[model samples]
Target chain A: MTAQIASSRVQRSSDMLAAPSLDSILALTAPGMECVNAVILTHMQSDIPLIPALAGHLISGGGKRMRPMLTVAGAELVGYAGEHQYKLAAAVEFIHTATLLHDDVVDGSDLRRGKAAANIIYGNPATVLVGDFLFSRAFQLMVGAQNLRVLDILATASAVIAEGEVDQLTAQRKVETTEAHYLDIIAAKTAALFAAACRVAAVVADRPAQEEQALDDYGRYLGVAFQLVDDAIDYDSEAAEMGKGKGDDFRDGKMTLPVILAYAAGDEEERQFWRDAIAGFLNSDEDLERAVTIIARHGTVAATRQRAEEYAQKAIAALSIFPPSPIRVAMEEAALFAVARRY
Target chain B: MTAQIASSRVQRSSDMLAAPSLDSILALTAPGMECVNAVILTHMQSDIPLIPALAGHLISGGGKRMRPMLTVAGAELVGYAGEHQYKLAAAVEFIHTATLLHDDVVDGSDLRRGKAAANIIYGNPATVLVGDFLFSRAFQLMVGAQNLRVLDILATASAVIAEGEVDQLTAQRKVETTEAHYLDIIAAKTAALFAAACRVAAVVADRPAQEEQALDDYGRYLGVAFQLVDDAIDYDSEAAEMGKGKGDDFRDGKMTLPVILAYAAGDEEERQFWRDAIAGFLNSDEDLERAVTIIARHGTVAATRQRAEEYAQKAIAALSIFPPSPIRVAMEEAALFAVARRY
Candidate 1:
């Protein structure tokens, strides 16, 4: 059955030149998305005005809500008809937002999602503390779901996400970071939550283990493809498209997959340039331009896109276990959209 | 029944000059505490060596483990014979440690528990991420307890604690902060966790709501007394004794009870001195001495200790409903010790 699904998905990808956009996918889950937004607004309340204010600043900043959309879409695809998915979707978004707040502080980045980061506006102490509040709120939402398995998935996912973040920190600024290590970091940091978000839909719908594992795989592959495209876009897109400045990963000395691939495939002179750039030696617009030229010359960006497309196809294949439906088609298209989107 | 307990507790406090020390209290709950220590060491484990290494550096830095001791003692006082209390105790410690790590980074402190702060040695990003990992680990531990009520209590307490920390930030350097505001902050920040820790024992043991309320009250009052004493010690104790520098609160312009009292009661000139000191104008050791002298002249430290004794007595009074046993006596003594401890 899996082999059949793989061949069918590959054939479908070749037939369909462009996947459905994020707006269309979100439109498929509009009602569920509205419920999640309501829950988010309600839970963000506190007697301490600063919490709701800062949280509002971030939540209203026009995030794509991609993770929560996956959660809602996953539930619909799995035939979950209950209201618990709304709370769980809100929970997933809360976890994601909490991490963004902390990530901004960790990276000392001034902007997030096309606005001044919360830490920049409210200061680090408020951002960190509010991040903690949102995290606790996320757990509260999970507990309200009243399903032990769902709780286990999310709680374990939270830990792995943190570890992945720490792993990324450990690997930062080191030109020697292998592609395998880079994959591990993104799998843990980004894909774990995505996997859990989808797997939880199966648990909520009381599906069998096979279905649960399939959904988890789908989300995991989709998440990897999404991050790969994000990293690639960091090199290729403008600040308006990427939400932050272009070449942010480069300036921050982040060891993304493209850099790792290019560094491994480069000549001695090229490798020296890569090493100096990652070590904080490269600083000007010209340096960034040259760096981009080198990356483009080696075709790493194209290669990176090809790798992302592979994961996107795998993600679509994972959905073959489910029968055809509007929700399932939307989820499959969402996977393709993840890799194909420029931003 | 409540009045009788309150009267008896007042009589006991006057009759006993010196309360049992923390050492004696820990010895009483030594077996349960040993179990908690084991769980802590186990949960702190990770494939990432940096995590366990940094967590160990802080965990083994000689914290009194007073919070977890309260959990064990609370369980013992309620006659809980099950082992879930050990896991809950460890969870409480994890939450506490996670907050300490974040607090150090938020405050930009160079030291914690008489050692170099985790951020100082490991860097801010690592400390923040590790703190996140520990917090996620804490939720996992709570889920292992398998009681929704226990989950509810800890989860609510975690949010309240973060809210309280933010409230403190809002109150920082504002000399006009009222005493009522300070009490609310400490009660939410410190006492909420203490209260929840003790209350979870009742939940785990399947005790009645009345008993749960009593234990929560006991922990709440004890936590307040402990924090009040800590604030007082900042103005009176040596750096080595307090595990951080002397006048650390004063230097940070923290609005503690001592500063609140002194500022409220001082003459205009003294108020001006306080206004300058708390605004970061006071810089030298001599300035701290004068600040202490001003506080002492108004007897604020002594008054603060007296207020702490009131809360300590209330903590003991709340525990009187529990049957008189070694654990009960030790818990009552622990209340007195909370206020009386010099360090």
Candidate 2:
């Protein structure tokens, strides 16, 4: 075992002592994730027919099942022996899928995951209704899990996620949004679920409070890092296409951290350009180009990446309480990948 | 007790032996409803300002709180002696209110409960997010109630409701929709919640499975009757304006029972007119007027009410297991009110 570990470390030294990939975590959790996927597929089905068709469109789309993966990985890290985490992990994924469906309608987006959004094909009415169906389906899955502590964690996370979405809506179209407010929004909308996903594993495993808190902190910081990098990549100017449509936040007049930082650091003339662009007056390709250029010149995208690294480090540190298993190594490297990935 | 019952019966005989009013049920469940209202107010709150504001706008509007009242009244009829029903009742109302907010967006309505809909005033995006918030809060409250059976019932009902909404969306503007299909839609979308709302009370009261099933039947039948009348009233020219904006079904190209019946019985020319109106080619006020005239010519509105009367009888009959009591009488009369009220 020591020889294998030494050889693996030697092999990864050229890649900063660990491979910047989710491969380790994905491999570690593959068996459990198969069960989670089965649970998700089973629960998303409905006699309505349209419900499954619409939900399957996005669920089968290339989401990577990141949230549910966190739940499974956390369960593995805690060395849980029960099968209850399968339904709970699927429930987490359902919550995430539901949010994506509603987010498409809320932003009136044309594309998601490099394809036409469910709202565009299914129409807004069906999209909204299907989102509701998936959300209700999520609760049903949680109830089937029969763990009230885990149910409460996910339920509270869901409410917080909705409030964050509403907060983002209220903050839309304003270049004056502060960094603190932006962080708050992302923390609620994204990190709350991630935290709950990890925390519930410890709850179901009957781990101590300190272990649950550590897992919660790990997932929360990783979620923030993931979202920050995502926002930065929207204007990265050199990255390939990720899952989401590029320039969506710009077109939607969303005040993400990169834009907020850029707006704060701009000259008067640059600020005027931002105010106009984010106000929806300047939304052409050329306008998007100029906005990207301004952000790049201000180096806020790089700054955003730098901030993401800090969160990723914190996420890694949150796992220090756990023993140094390969699962721990995979989880820490996954945080690095969250910061390092461009697409 | 017998003398008082005789006196009340003699007094009610002047108004047809059972009053066409909700006053009886309201009087019986007033104290319980007070607690439900308090729970609703407490739970709808959020740190985000817009959530409570948007939710409260429609919640405080005069909609009679019928779903929650069913919960409270069911508890009374079952002789429950606990406070948990209050939270469960409030949870039921939250589910209903969440759907209403989403319905406003789905239908693109200008008014709800005789006032400006939340979607109209707060914009569709905020309305959708707030609806999500309330839904999550509903489950949170249900978790606090600590009854997995009640949670399963409500969760199942919520998914059915969403499926019904999606099914309706699929059936919209298609005049070939069958009556059976329409009934299926209404039963799933509207009656499922009502059934779950009543049944949860029995579950929390720890009643026999038979009692739970009985309450479910009563609520399901009452909901169908209530919806049948609501649809009939939309096309009923003799009726005064209910809370909803009149002619909404006509304008939205919805195929309710009246329109379905009118089309089935109309002459060739009338059928063509029905198709044109339902397909959105002719949605003027004059078109709505002509549509109503044609429906009246076939007497479908009266026929629809006749159908509602049958369901109301079934609803009242579902209470046969209960012994003679004022609460039982009040519930039976409420079912009658579901049929008799013009609005």
Candidate 3:
């Protein structure tokens, strides 16, 4: 009971630092959640000297450890009080980190979260291998859970995420890339983990089937909204405003949401620029400026944000089946803030 | 029943091409095993135009698909009868391909199996992404198995393999790389999956615990033997006979098993050569030859082969626990041949 009170105090302190909606959900999470999270966080980092050097550069860069948080939070919501949540938390983080590592490699990204990308610092081989290491470790931890439902969810998500990445790779430059294709890829690659994270929480808690489906839906929509906003911010904000420093997605000729929308609205010349020059390389600062101008003209930036909002609203709607609780309320608001955040 | 007989016949035919002991186990696997092998053979080839062009050059150049073959053979030994075995066979191949992709990237090797590597042909980015794609696909197929044991084994193997690769990266030129260190790295990078493959076969069959453990032991020892032989072959075989291979480990200064063995043997001149030239770079053919002469004089090549043989023997011993079936017999022989094969 003393432990529970101490955890609550910690949660309250952390909640104060988060967004309003996040604060509420953060509060609702069980007192033991921190113990699980701490266990996961400690184990997730590599003990290998070089591995730690590279990972230190990453873990310090700071994305909201949201996926793992979801796992822990959902488990708590489902009434699970066991230590398995820690293992699940580590497992989820591993998968997430693996994807990020690969994404950097694929993009040849120089920076992530305002630091040098792993590939940039350690080279592609090390980055890729480390990513693989994280993936394998994640599985080891998940297996420790010894829950078929959790295993199935994670495995399926892992595969779908890869397929989604592949789809993005193939579809990135093509004008024929559709909304459906984008949604499909996002659902597989991004949302699947989010869905699985929440659903597994329910599995751990032994929650009712309907409640599990609701949480799964909530996570799926939340992931979609998060991605949509991510894509939107790339085009809408400048380096100074967005910590990303520069929008490389446009420069890289990626057919992100803004590009998709712009392509839909623009003329043959615009399409030709994308195909010949921008798609291949950004020739100069002028090319970037022109690309931005074209995206603005297409109303893609606003449209993308609106779509993100729709997804967030849908995420909130999914929580309707759950009985009213501070955590559920917080989840509803966090979905909105996820897209609304500056960075 | 007819399908099973047909598969057995096919296996027998393939086994006829190998050593006598391997032939018997080939006849014991279920009909679906062939289907799994087929999937592996088909998907293992890269479809990226340049990737395939390079892979075809390599595959046709005749590197044995030893890993995939081991996977299928292990499934047979365990009396696995499901269609999922075929998917697993493909999954194992994907994992193997991913490692090879990363290996080429790290080694910066132009040739593998005889032909140009994927990285050499398509560049590092393409190779890395394709490797990621294969890994994700492997995970996906494993998920379809809905077997937690299989997932756990494969996942853990993947992580260990990555760690081994990374360990090699740092320890490349260092003479301090001990036999234990070498074993640790290779066990994770190479043998873990081999063991996992056989163990998963037992898992799919829901075999007895002791039988499963035996199969896993066989795989672990077989993988160790196979890697030891491969490392030894780098020293003993002619470049031409070894398929576009060069004694590049010495030239590039990787502290492989033979080098470690020779270094530990305490030849002052050989140690100096390793420190000065092999640890740096072989400047000329003379340097390469000198290094080779030192290794030969140290009897390291013979010692390494002896170690490989010991592992193979141990692998054979592991199979004593299994029932006296033709499949089990073939499995035992295959483990021996894994070390004994010249190329």
Candidate 4:
């Protein structure tokens, strides 16, 4: 009786103290992720050496492959028995990869995943063309899945992603951008794919509409939570080393949540600093440091983290419809991990 | 009898003297084109203001809408009675427009179809993102067509097109690119979509594979012929003032047939000049004029035009399998026009 009580206490104490990790979901989908990775490798290739070379540079980089993982994990949750989910998972990844490639070009990013960005290595022309190749290949994989509804969902998501990118571009450096508009941009650019990625798993499994909707909600909220954290970390003075350059958004004048909230709460002098910085006049490292200091002063970075936690909760709640299985628990933990990760 | 003889003689003389025109094909597809244009206008729009503004800049620019016209005319040839062709046609134009937008970014071009390139006005970031938006919109439109096979064909063609583009980028400024490799490049980058555009008509019409193959052949040859003429016109000393910047390929060191043939036919000294010019060591208007002079001296521009005529002939003969109809006659004339036009 003493040993049983001590062991239970250890378990409860560990659960309480330990930060959430993706270990459960990763283990659950490891085998299927192997299959999806195989599909990605096989499909991202072309007879043109440059095509495969450029695509491989980014794909083989240490990406979490989070989008495809969601598909496979969602499949496991629904007990999908077919092989089509692998291909669909790969499709989800290609769309994400395509967007990343284009995103690097649009942002003129110098690095991705801590390596030089594809555009930096391959030049913008080849990078852009290869992105097109992968996107087209994504649709080809989707067509191979032979589910028209999945095609409709992913196609619409892709368009929305582009529109969101454009919207973000328009909002860049604009001090007047509202928080609501910021949320809409993230929902469209980032969450749409996440939702489609998870929803496609239920789709290929021929599951019920309720299960599909549940997965969609789960993925969408998780995406929003993840992006919020990403934006916050850019201004997080104590954040860990990340794959991207430090203060990238600040230098680029991206109007992320921390900046918006800080600007909203700033006094005359702080607001003047913000208006000048975001307008592209102040783009030095010192300026970035100043921006981060102001954001920390206003506690907006922590505020943004708190906001992300709310979305993470919504993501977890969306999974309640699923039964109390290990996969469901894994997914819920993954949502928590979305906002919990330092980088 | 006397009046009939005089009128017949006048008709014969005028037919012999008149240069080939797209008039017949244009008139044949006019009604269908209006519907296709309406579909294009309706679909190219987005809630994002920049998308419509940038897209309209190119779409409203005096584009001939030739690709969609081919679809509508092909439908007429096969007697396809469905309305799906219009949507498919619009989808084809979107793909083409998306490529054009990206191409301008890739080439860092200043003008397209006689006005400032989209990149020049909207900036590269917006240009790249809008291209992606249109490409996704193209896929959405294809999905709306609700034909799995059509989607497959276009998806495959789109991949091939990107592959071809990458291959061309690989081949740029390489003086060793052979005639055969050049042909392969054009076949992939330019002809694949043309072939798919025409083949889908036969597909939606539920025509036999033989007819599908015939349309594919027709379109593929015509595309080659058109590209040949376009390249030749860039070097054609007397060619009309064009919408594009003059000698763009030459300045970019693109290995078009004129360059390949000129390099092959020249002596060591002449080849050295060709090599230096193509390697970007020479890229002034004076250099362009000198290059044009050399091309004119070797008559390679005429040689390229002659080569185009041969493909145009093949394009015409491919349509011979169809029973004689006004649409068939118009398509045949369009092939002839593809070669006969100077600009």
lDDT of 4: 0.91
| lDDT of model 4, residue A284 | 93
- The predicted structure with the larger TM-score, 3 or 4, is 4
Q: Is candidate 1 or candidate 3 better by lDDT?
A: 1
lDDT score, candidate 4, position A98? 92
Best by TM-score: 2
What would the C-alpha RMSD of candidate 2 be, to one decimal place?
A: 2.2
lDDT of 4 by residue, B1-343 (tens): 1556435433433463267778777877889999999998999889999999999999999888889999999999999989999999999999999999999999999999989999999999999999999999999998988888889999999999999899999999888899999999999999999999999999988999999999999999999999999999999999996788999998998999988899899889889988888889999999999989989989999999999999999998999899877677778778888888877
lDDT of 4 at B280: 91
In model 1, the runs with Cα more than 4 Å from the true position are A1-16, A237-240, B1-16, B237-240
**Residue A167, model 4, lDDT:** 97
- TM-score for each candidate, following the candidate numbering: 0.95, 0.96, 0.85, 0.96
Candidate 2: pairs in clash? none
Candidate 2 lDDT by residue in tens digits, A1-343: 3568635733553475344988777777889999998998888988888899999999999787888998998998999999989999999998999999999999998889998999999898899999999999989988887888888899999999999999999899988899999999999999999999999999999999999999999999999999999999999998888777889899999998889899889999999999998899999999999999999898999999999999999999999999877778888888999999989
Model 1, span B169-212: residue lDDT tens: 99888889999999999999999999999999999999999999
Per-residue lDDT of candidate 1, residues A91-110 (tens digit): 99999999999998999988
lDDT of each residue in B1-343, candidate 3, tens digit only: 3667546644664554355344444444434456765665565454334434433443445555556566677766666766566677678877887788778877788888777777777676566656765676677677777787888788878877887888888777787888998888788778988888777777888888998899889889999998887888877844224653677677667788888988888667667777877568554778877767777888887898899989988998999877655566567667766666666
User: Residue A269: error of model 1 in Å?
Assistant: 0.8
Write down the TM-score for model 3: 0.85
RMSD of candidates 1 onward, in order: 4.6, 2.2, 5.1, 4.1
Native contacts matched by each model: 0.70, 0.85, 0.55, 0.84
